[model samples]
Target: MRSVLDRGLALYRQGEDLPAEELAKCTALAVQLAERGERIAPLLHAWDVGCSVAVAACWVSARPGEQSELVSLTQWSSVGVKEITAAISLAYVHAQKQAGLDTSRRVLADLMLNGSATDELAAAAHHSPAKEYVAVAGRVVGENVPSAATVARASAALTTGDLGLSCQAGRHLCILAPIRSHRSTEELSGHMVETLKRVGITFAAPAGAVIAPRSELAMAVQQASRIESLAGIAGLDGKTVESSQVISELAISRDGEYRRQLISLIDPIVEAPELLKTLRTLYLMDLDRSRTARRLNVARRTLTYRLERIEQLTGINPVRTRGILAFVLALAARDLDLSSSVPEGV
Candidate 1:
């Protein structure tokens, strides 16, 4: 049998020419997937773009000799045609649920990336009135990322009545959902994590999420992405990590320039494995010089010399609160493995 997306759109006629039954299949499948905890955003998004192209093709195909306008815009490739047809199938599905709801371009673009939601997205992005909003960003370990619409649909199932939206956004699976007034972010976050796990999600790292006001959904997303990374590094693999759980890392991470400065302080030490180990161990042991020396199995004088050398090179003494904070933050940043990808944004 032809896929739900391609079963129709054949023998192109005109925009909205696709049959109601064929289009309805896409909608039915979307709802079904959402109910069963599958991702649907990417699938619907594919449908959106695909259908838009298909209609454009149908419009041009009907024009025939008057195709000059259509020719410039379309590449006329087989893949391009297939994509547009899929989109038509997707749009028809939406038309089924919301009648004339277009989802608009703004919603589609936002869903295609891992970021926050802006006020503009509310119109077509399924905004609902709720006391809390949680934005999720997750990626499967390999190429087997679930279809977009399938993931989105899965997210919606969590709403259990409240307004929710979920979808595959680029490499991440995302959700924008509301919280009941009685539900705490921790409860919601933990529940979502467990739910995703129960559904057998094959994420490389567990999902990351942030719950906040609608106005900060975008920043929440960025924070969630980082929390996911930090959790992975902290050995909390395959568990949902929320922003509230990592306050210090979140604070240290916010300043792009300050993070760089902290990292710079450790660069000179990095070249010397012994010195790196010394300072890292010192900080890791909570400034216990005796314990650090004993763990390294070095004499007191040797430990003293290494500390002096670290101070000489970085000019930051580990004994001082400010200096130790900087040292620990730098290593924590390294431990989180964000030394490179962090600067690029979520």
Candidate 2:
């Protein structure tokens, strides 16, 4: 919430209009709060505080002999703040009517993913068959997981042109967004992260592949989910992992024998907990020796010794290109059993 306020203030300081995207984010947060049994008072209170802070910002930035314009500035700020507050209040009321649920969006998401969306539902949800789209799959973490409807509403607010659809399928949150540009997936995912943060919801989803046709959405979602799991195994959390970032590990994760062989490459270092930690930290830090040593809270000399020990045990240098890739893939393959991966048309 503080971050949201700060972001709003930053935009104001820069003399920029509050984009529709930011307003949509506010609506999403209002829905979440109202769903959680919060009243409109807190939302208004936050807005009031924002108005005060924004006024203070204006005062500080006022030029010499501009005292006469302060009244004009205050009036303008008051109007803008009131409008934003009213919009958020209306969103709260709307959410209350649905008991803070987006049941329709959830149903629509399920139907689309299963290829069962009726023409009516597709039309209502604004899903276009001829449009290009992308799937972002994730698992909600932390104490407060936003409902699928809330996610869909938030995604829709951030989406341009036709709105996107989202739903929670078992443990995964699947969002289908129309591709507005090459960076549509990246921008939407980033907005989701920011909006959800205001209400304390986070996703452990990575970037998903683009879907040229609506028919492949389900498969792309499933594949994204699998990549998400792969990222988890590599100790990557939040939205930090991209599909492209883990392509190599994903490629070798399927073969049972090959996976075991890769895991074995690190098995020797695994027996020594310190050495294993060092190796993992090294990779996590992108093989930066100085940073890795500082993260491990060890002297550079000690860090070097651990790297040497890992090489002695695994017969692979940890610093070189081939060696680093091998170790990273090995670590990713560990505990990644995809035998029960999502089946087609599921």
Question: Evaluated with lDDT, which candidate comes out highest?
Answer: 2
- Please name the candidate that would achieve the greatest TM-score relative to the true structure: 2
lDDT of each: 0.60, 0.65
Worst ten-residue run, lDDT, model 2? 337-346
Report RMSD for candidate 2. Answer: 20.2
TM-score of each: 0.53, 0.60
Scored by lDDT, model 1 comes in at 0.60
Cα deviation of 204, candidate 2, in Å: 3.9
Taking the tens digit of each residue's C-alpha lDDT, what string does model 2 give over 264-305? 898887778898789888988888999999999999999999
Instruction: Give each model's clash number.
Output: 26, 0
